[model samples]
Structure formats: C-alpha cells, structure tokens
Target: MSLGGKVWITWTRKTKSNYVGKIILAAALTALCILMLKQSPSFNSRSPFSNHEPGVTHVLVTGGAGYIGSHAALRLLKDSHRVTVVDNLSRGNMGAVKVLQELFPEPGRLQFIYADLGNAKAVNKIFAENAFDAVMHFAAVAYVGESTLDPLKYYHNITSNTLVVLEAMAAHGVKTLIYSSTCATYGEPEKMPITEETPQLPINPYGKAKKMAEDIILDFHKNSNMAIMILRLFHPHVSFFHYFSLSVKTQMARLGEAPRPELREHGRISGACFDAARGIIPGLKVRGVDYKTPDGTCIRDYIDVTDLVDAHVKALEKAMPGKVGIYNVGTGRDQSRSLLRHVRRLTGVNIKVDFLPRRPGDYAEVFSDPSKILLELNWTAQYTDLQKSLGIAWRWQKLHRNGYGTSVTIADS
Candidate 1:
C-alpha cells in the first residue's frame, strides 16, 4: 500500500460520518415540529374553544341584561363565544347590554332580544331564528321578601317560566343548560358549610320556587338527552358595572329606612354601603340584627361576581350529554358584621348603621363547601379578599351612580 491511498481512504470515512450526523439532527427537528403541531389543539384557559369543535359557540343568555347574566355574557364574549342576550327588561337594564356591545365591538359577536322567557312562543321563535349551543337561564324574580309577600308571583315567574324555557329548549333540541339557582334553595342548613348533598327544604317562596324549578329541570334531564348544571349560588357581590339593580327605595322600604329623593332607585348593600361612606345616603340600614350569629346578624358567603361567572363558564365547558352537575358557588367563608367593617375599611369612612329587627324567613348563617367544584372543574375563587371585593364594587358603584345610566324599557325590536 502507498501513502496517498491511506490518506484518501481515511478522508472518505470521516466525510460519511459527518453526513450521517447532519441527517440524524434534521430528522430529530422534524419529529419535534410534528409533535408540537399535534398537541397544539389542547385545552387553553384563555379560550374554551381551543379543544372544542371548530366554529364559535352561540350561547343564549336569558336575562343577560341583568347583573350576573350580564357579567357571564361579558366572560363568554372575552372567550370568543357569540352571545345572544334575551331580557324582558322588567328587571334587566339595557345599558348593561349596551356596555357589552361596546366592549366586544365585533359585529354579530353579541346580540340582544327583548323577549320574556314566560312567553313560550317568543322563546321558541328565538331558538328557531338562531342555532344556540347552550342556554344560561338567569331570568327569575329573586326578591326574597317580595316572594314571601306575593307567593303566586314567585311561582309564576320562577316555576312556570322555567317550564316554558325548558319546553322551548326541548323543541329546539338545545341539550345544554346552565341554570342560575340559589343557596336559598337549601334553606337554613342544619350543618355548617352547606354542600350539594344538603336537603333542599327551602323555607321561603323564593327558595321553594327555585327548588321546584330545579326539580322540573332534573326531571327533564332524566327523560331527555339534556346536560344540566344547577349552580346553587351564594351572595355574589357587585361586578365591574354593578349588575344587581333592585330599586333603592324598595330596599329601603324593606329595611324600614326612609327613601331619599336624591338616591337612585337601584342599589344593593354593597352600593348602599358605598353611598353611605360617600355621604350619598343618610347611613347604612342594617336589616335583621338579631339573628343567631356571632354578630347577631345574618351571615352569608359573599363570592365576587367575576368569580361566580367564571364557575359558570367552567360548567359550560364541562357539561356532558345526559348528565346533571350540581355545584355550590361561594367563598365557603361566613361573613356577617365583618362585611360592614370591610366596607368601611375599603371606603375609609366611618359608615353609620341603623340596626333593625330580623326579617321573616331570614337564615342566621349560610355559606358553602365548594370542594367538589374545586376538585371537579379545577376552579377556585380568585377575588377572595373581602376588602378587595368591596373596593372593586365601590369603584363601580361610584362611577355608575345612576345604575346603568337609564331604566330598562321594553325594546321595539
């Protein structure tokens, strides 16, 4: 063998080894790209439709012009879902709907219909016009005292209207329903931290009507292919725009407080407390200060409106065909007189209080045990700080002092 032949042979072997290394690296890169593409459609917290079937979901939010409903609609819009809001405007504000429209700004992403759920023909017509993937029913007369005074009205609005909605849903074959139930359906629970298993012995007509509606929905679910989620919500505090808008006079009248001429008709305890701190109202009127609690006042689990709506969104995603899911939405913490203290701290004002006797059908304490929802849906309350919640509520109430800018009216459309 010669020196030239040995050198040529060694160079050829080294060149081939380098070529094979480059090919292996190229193949590894290609495999990684393919794997990423395959896993790209997995679940996304920002957008619920990432893992779902293609095309935006159309959700019919009954009472979407109302407080909680409006917030839920806002969340749905944020997650790229098309929302159609149906409201009678009897207890809902059109200004809330207007706000939603302005926020989304995308044409056809949000819509509003002036229709009562009790009117089956109108509800059916709505379903016929649009293909709704789900229905979040929040339309109901929820005033506890008023329901007690006029039990028939509660039955008509809560019970009968629910039946009408269900009938329309069945006709349209809309299988998914997210019902807005209340913790009041459990009445005064014998145990602390009420769970879904608690007996539903509602003490008032309002609670009874909700319970009755729940029964009707469950029956319909059993007989049909409907997926039902009954959320027994606790006290949901104010949202960004302050959704719950009971008349200030009505609330004052219930508490035996003198109505002020300057005050707007719509406000809640959070708003009222904020107003009192700002000297808008005379002072905070504390109703039922003689309840059997540590502070001798009724205790409730106050969850932020945003948190409550988030749970609904999760439930919508998790709803399965021919299944019934019941979850309690609350902070699972008791808040009584400390709520007022928190409000005072948030407002940085010494809020005056006018204590009154306990109202009828008032429970001493009612909170929630939301472990099941936490474990099942991987959902938990984000705005759990009482001061922070009240601060947000106070800011919103201060800006929208008139409550939605105008009273709701029946739309011509």
Candidate 2:
C-alpha cells in the first residue's frame, strides 16, 4: 500500500476551478488528519514481572493457535500465568499449538481445547472444568476481500459466533474480556493515523463484523460490568527475528560509507525458501517502489510479534472497575514496500522490480497512534526500527519455511 501522497481528492473540494475553495478544503483535510493523529490511543507494555497480580490468575485465550493468538499465549505464559487455549483447528494448526504449549509458564497450567467458540455448551464446559479469572477473545473470521465477497460467512462466523460466546461469558460470569479488534474497521481513513475515537467507517464485511463485535462487547461492559480491553491490532510481525536482523543491517549501513547500498550475504532476501540442507533462500520481490512514500513504496506498521502480544497481556491487566480502554497496536512507523529494494538498500540484495497493481481490499497506508496506551498503560513499542524488524521477519520465515513455528505446509496443494 502507498503510504504518502502530495495530492488528494476531497469531498469538500469542488471540481470547478476555484483556487480559494481548493485551498480551504485542503487545509480542512490536513487539519482533520492531524486531529486523528493527535487523538490516537497509545500502546505500550510493562514487563510481565511487574504487571502480574497478587494471586495466581488463570487466563483463557480463545483462538490460541493462530498467529496473534499463539503470540499472546506465549506472553501470558511468560509472565507465569496459568493459561487455557481453545481453538477449533479450522485455520489453526496442531504444530503451532504444540509449539506454543512448550512456552507455557508451568506444567499442567497451560492446556488446549479443540472446540468452536459458537458452541456455548462447549465453552461453558471448558470454564466449568477450569477456573478462569479472565478471557481473551481472538477467534474470528479475518479477511477483508474474502469477507466482502462472502459476507454471510463473515457475519455468521464473526458476528453470530461472537454473540454466542458473549452469551456464554454472561452465563458463566466471565467479566474480563480482551477482544482482538482490527485496523480494517478504520477503512480508508480520511486521515493518516487512526485513533480509538476515530469514526469506524469500515468499507468491508470483515471490518463491519469486527466493529459489531466491539460494540456488543462494550455494551456488555456497560451492563455486565465486564473489564474489557479492546485492542485494535495492526499488521503481523514477529519479534525475535525482526529485531535481530535490524541490529545487523543498521550496523552494516553505518560501518561502511558506500553512499549507496551494499549487499549482505546471509541476510539476502529469500525470494522463496527451500528446506534443503543448504539453508533457506527467501523469494525477493523488486516491485512496490512507485508508492507515495519517500521511496515511492508502501509503508506498514509491522509490530514485532512479541511486542504485539506483550501489549495484549498488559492490556488485559490494565482494565479497571467501570471503564474499558481501547488501544492501537503498531510501531507507529513506516516500512518500505519494495522487499528487494529494502533488502538491496539495507542488506544489499540485487533484485529486479516486478510491478503490479495494488490488490483489491488493499489499504494505501495503515499505522497506529499508540500514544494513548503509553500515557495510560506506561507502555511503549520496544522494537522501533523497520529494517531491524524486516531482518527478524526474514529470519523467522527462513527457519520456519519447513513449518518451523506454525503448521502451514504447502506441497502443490
């Protein structure tokens, strides 16, 4: 997605040649976008050790096998909290689930259930079997384009199922809920950065469903007295891999005065990875430059997967007696879209650009205003640089190309 642009079409602007009107409209839009940024919610996390509560707490994280789910589960476990995971295994893999299990705090403290959230009986049964102090909901249908085409499925799975889960929560008296909201709800923001107070103008079914779920959850928060933290999750990112890579690349860039870009060996862009004895070779893409950003490429908010989950863990604890806190999760930074160009510039990988039109349902640019969370929760994004983050992602991608982290195997399927 393109990040920045000098020109924009405004609803207030008239097509006719009216220079004064155009200037006024431009100023209005610029002011509105700035307001969105200034009003954005903050996101930061305290160390797990300091954040833990008085007594032992048992937490239930639904959809604990998926990407963000797994990451959150690990964070909860890292803090020595008891955790129970429930996943239907539709889009979740057993391998990812198993890997996450190993990261648990203690033995028998972390458990997994293979069940759907829609089935209140099943959810109730799990709660009855184990005492849970809080519940983190991450299970839902997620896909902007897919949701648009087949809205019913999105509605049924995300909206209907979430309602059922809420009912179950009410029945079981589970008041603490941490919802995994999405940035899609912001939908082609009239402004650059989006805040919690920004009007939810979703243009797709998935965003609508997520927004509906948030509304329902907040309603419950009002009546049921649930302590909820609605986290508006941004792009996907892995912490360990990306942070490490950035350190290496940044060091190299400053060490040598190439004035241009250099090429790095082990850090070469993996155009595609093959799990051979040699190692992983990432597929390199040269396109994505001509965007509106500085390099004419896409810019994204790729929070380290670790930081993403850390925020969730902190968010769950931050909820209070009567109010619910909504926060955005992202680096609040931009990343270049041209993987090859970035690799070449940062790591020095030579690759060709292959231009392609933006995909349907693609957002031009999306980032977070995590200032609120920082002010409220005393949290800040640990991994601040993008190049370091990309290096981490590439490393994780390489190691896991053989289904290292999650179980996603493709053999001409």
Candidate closest to the true structure, highest lDDT: 1
Best by TM-score: 1
TM-scores, one per candidate: 0.78, 0.70
lDDT of 1: 0.78
Candidate 2 lDDT tens digits, 61-131: 88877666766776677677778889997655566666655544355567888998878788778766666
Clashes of 1: 3
Q: 99, model 1: CA deviation in Å?
A: 0.6
The deviation in Å at residue 367 for candidate 2 is 1.9
Candidate 2 weakest ten by summed lDDT: 253-262
lDDT, residue 100, model 2: 59
CA lDDT for candidate 2: 0.64
In angstroms, give how far residue 380 of model 2 lies from its true place.
1.4
lDDT (Cα atoms) of all candidates against the true structure: 0.78, 0.64
